[model samples]
Target chain A: MVKRLSVLDANRCTGCQSCMFACSRRFGVGGLAYSAIHVRSVGGIEHGFVVIVCRACPDPPCAKVCPVDALKVRVGGGVILDAAKCIGCGFCAKSCPYGAIFWNERENKPNICVYCGYCAGYCPHEVIALEELG
Target chain B: MDEYLKNILYIDLSRKRFWVEDRGSLFEEYLGGVGVASKILLEECPKNADPLGPENVIVFAVGPLNGLFPLASKTVACFKSPLTKSYGESHAGGRSAIAIRQAGYGAIVIKGASETPVYVAVHGKNIIFRNASALWGLRNSITVGRVLREIEGGAGVRTIMRIGVAGENLVSYASVNTETYRHFGRLGLGAVFGSKKLKAVIVSGKTMISVSNVKRYRELYDKIYTTSIKSSVMKKYHDLGTASNIIPLNTIHALPTKNLRESSFEYAENISGERLAEKYLGRRVACAHCPIACIHLAALREPYVTEPYFYKTTMISYDHELLYALGSMIGVKDTEGVLKLIDEVEKWGVDAMMTGTVLAWMTEAYERGIVGENEILGLKLEWGSVESYTKAIEYIVKGVNEFYKTASKGLDALTSRYGGEEFSLSYGGNGMPGYHTGPGAHLTYLTGARHSHLDSAGYSLDQETLKGKQLSEKEIAEKLYHEESWRQILSSLVVCFFSRGIYTPETVCETLDILGYSFNEVELKRLGEKILSNKNDFKEREGFNMLNQRFPKRIFETPTPFGLLEEKTLYESVKEFYKILKERARNS
Candidate 1:
């Protein structure tokens, strides 16, 4: 069993981008450029926010779409990106159904969630959490 | 130099040319936001420039902490004000700051007037000038935003800033609405946009920002986050939003009602924060980097008149200012009526505070037979009359006649022609804020830069006085000067005023140190003071004289929570404020 970050209840999300900041801060960086998780309004903020994060799929489409075999399926769920092999084509970013894969334009690499669960800790509203999956 | 604060994007609308300049030196000296924008304005904007002409320049700047820190979500917009006719600045909290920072620019300066309508799109390093002839005359800002959103797809990280019919008509008090809910709501930014034939601006970017100290950065981030969530400092703002001030202000007789004829509204309870939360509160949203979700949206559901079983749901954001301006000030008793007027104001892209103040004056003027039915287009203007106010809003946007056209300019222009100068309720050519707290509030309105209540928050001083703290006029003036000077640092950082308690000078210095900018607490204070002085210098250059400001006679007629404000006491306080300003200018 392994724990993964999950969107428990998106309606509780405030679109604060605290989780997004947390994800980037983990890399000793600031701004949303490298964050794996994305939160956007449904239309306007009134309808509430949609928290988009990797669901740790068994057969991740993002991993399969990588031209250079840069992404690999993790043991628990989700995919791990091999930065060395990445070509920066952004195919993996487009292939992710949830739009969870992010592009690091400066480094020319894919920013996929490593299931670190750091972002869940910053969500004040309990909109996201780290949960175990078997 | 910090990677985020590297470049400035300059757009010449008249020549349809755009260029990016290295402004690392400017950011280094001024930090960012108003600090940098003000310097840009002084350098670029001509002296005594017509606010609605090619000479005027619009500068939008975001601070270094914008995309990096929590609650640093404001984008400062600086331009020559059509309303105040002086140094003008407005801040909007939305995705605007983040978008601008990530787009690889510390600031953006728009100059010259376009021959035809256009909308500028800045996506990363690419700047696209699109023909906006079709979108120019759109009735509402929301529609313009939707159209731009459809064409330009940067869903999460993009900010759409557009104007409505009010702006297109060159209304002096028109606002530039951002993200539909937030706005550069004061000092006529939208009129500047209209004058340039610029309809909207879409800013989107994705760029990583690096920090010098990783370990120290994480520690500081955790400390700020813990303080933000655990502390009760932000509880009130998060709970009921700024609308929570309604009950307290009304209770203390600080809430101005019916154009300052009365200090408190009798039906304040019906359109209060408690009532809105209980009955109409739909959702709470936040700006990009802020954890406190202070933006409250009310769910207004209405049925179609012609169709059966068809209903439309509109979400309107409300705050204490809106509640004061459109709700109690106009004598609107019900939350529904307030929401309806707010919705109309948002659609028209007009400043709600100015609109309400003008309408309150008009309602009183009509009652006194100064303005007849001819000016109102046969609509009878009366207090709490939602129908009449709705029609008036339409007329103001349309500019149907001389009265509506003059009113569109602002209270200063309207009252000067229409004979309502006694109760115009304008301070420094800008509509007074919601606070009629006491002398502190009134003095701040008169002398504060931009004539905004948030400049010094004299309402807090009034509250302290109500709690049995008696102070002289000079002491009150000193307190306001101190607060206003310190706020320059916060605005330079582009942080929200709500987080003033969290980000002290020490903490701010620590954060800046981590970001590779070294500054002690003393240096930070000096920087704040210098910024304030520079802004005042700009104002002075543009013909703003503290001694020449006219105190509205109506405010003196009404008694506040403290008592009747005396003319002598106010004059002495203004003189003290002038002394402080002179001392600071000399020191800087």
Candidate 2:
């Protein structure tokens, strides 16, 4: 069984992206310099917001495009990144349909969500939730 | 640090040469954004400088946290305002902060005026003066924004700050629109732009930033973000937007209706946020990195009068202020009517609050028989008559006649000439923001440096005192002083006051720590006081006087949610405020 996190209700999202910022902060960074996820206004903002995060697909394209084998499937059915092996080629970042894989140009690596569920705990709007599927 | 800040960009249309100068020490002491910008204006701008002349400098500045942090997304624009003739500061969120930061510089200083129509474009670090000959006369603000977006690179990353026909025509209360919906909405910054023959300024940058404590910064960033997004405190703003204030205000009988003739509207339900959301809400949007996307857009699906298949549906942004000004203040019952008026005002780039107040003045003028149809350019002006008022607004923007010119100057000129100061509804020459909340709001508008609602948030004090007791004069003055003092710090951090609870004095100190500026709670208070003094200095240099300042008689006429405000009491309250400020200034 692998757990996936999703923003089921966007109206509930304050657009605070505390989750994405938190993930980058959890990596011990000061700003959004290297956050794994991005929250952007969808189609000119009168339309509300869309949270772009990994869907934890069984056919995860991010893992498939990792030429250096830096990304692998974790025990919980989520993707994990071995940062030491990443060449920062941005191939996986380009392959991510959801654009969840963030590139940190300064550190030369790809930042990915590991389903630690750290961000879900901080979402004040209950906009993000982690669920397990068998 | 020294290499990052180069020459301050000086564009003088009167002189026609754009030059750069060095003024870096001011930044180190005052910090960038409001503090440094204020100090610079006071030092450079001469006494009694004609606000609409080539002398007044418009400064656009970004703070240290900008580009480095996701939430550091506010840009502080400082200039001597044509509206207040005092130090004017307006902070806007959008791509403004990011654009300035990415341009690899902290501040831009613009002076002089252009003889012909022009605009400025800054890409990376290079600056170019573009001939805005064709774009100069556009009435629609969004049209100007769209044209700039298409012609320029960095569509999403850049900020297109343009003035509409209102600014081009020197409307005293004109605002500069950026990112389509966001504005430097107060104190006639747009009029200054218009006076300079400058139509617009576009900024875009794509530079990387270095952080000191990457790990700790990330940790704190995550903590703040999660806490903010998940908090129920933001629910009201996110869902219904500021329109949520409509129901509560109406419930309290504080909704200013029909130019303060009534506190609440009978057809308030039709114009309430609850109604707008249910009937016309197209979507909710957020400003650049902010999770509390409080921007609400209404879908105006109207029939095309010419063809059945050619229906026009436009999405227009709405908020509490617009709802109050265009809705209750003007006696508008139809949400669609309110939306149409709001859209038109925004397109023309006039300050919505001032425009509403101006319309309210015209409505009263018609009622009082001060002006007639010939003066009105044949538009039948009436309260709640959106059809006629819409035409009047267009005429005002186009500067159709002498009356339109004065109306465009703001209510002060109209009242001064026409004898309607009693109900003119202006404070320090700026129109009243929703809520005749009480003496705090009135006194703040009367004396606060900017004459802006955000200056001291006096409305908050009124709400607090509403719990069955009127505040003593001394007590009210103290509260206003403390609040305005603290807001100086908030504006320095450029934090949104709406999120004051989460970013308490303690949190503000901690956030400053991340940027290596450590100050205790007490020190933060002192910094705020110093900044307040600096702003007052700018006002004093411009010869701003509290004496002989016009306090609208309309305020006394209209009974508020709290009570009918007495003239003697209000004047006494204002005197008390002035006396305390004078004493404090002398001591400091």
Best by TM-score: 1
Each model's DockQ?
A: 0.83, 0.25
lDDT score, candidate 2: 0.77
Residue B531 local lDDT, model 1: 88
TM-score of chain B of each: 0.99, 0.95
How many steric clashes does model 2 contain?
29
Please give the lDDT score at residue A59 for candidate 2.
70
Predicted candidate 2 versus true structure: per-residue lDDT over B377-461, tens digit per residue: 7777788999988998888887889898789888888888787777788887888888777778887887677887778878778
Computed on alpha carbons, the lDDT of every model, listed in order, comes to 0.90, 0.77
Q: Which stretches of candidate 1 lie over 4 Å from their true place?
A: none
Docking class of 1: high
After superposition, candidate 2 runs with Cα above 4 Å error: A1-43, A47-134, B1-25, B65-72, B206-209
Q: Model 2 chain B — which ten-residue stretch has the worst lDDT? A: B1-10
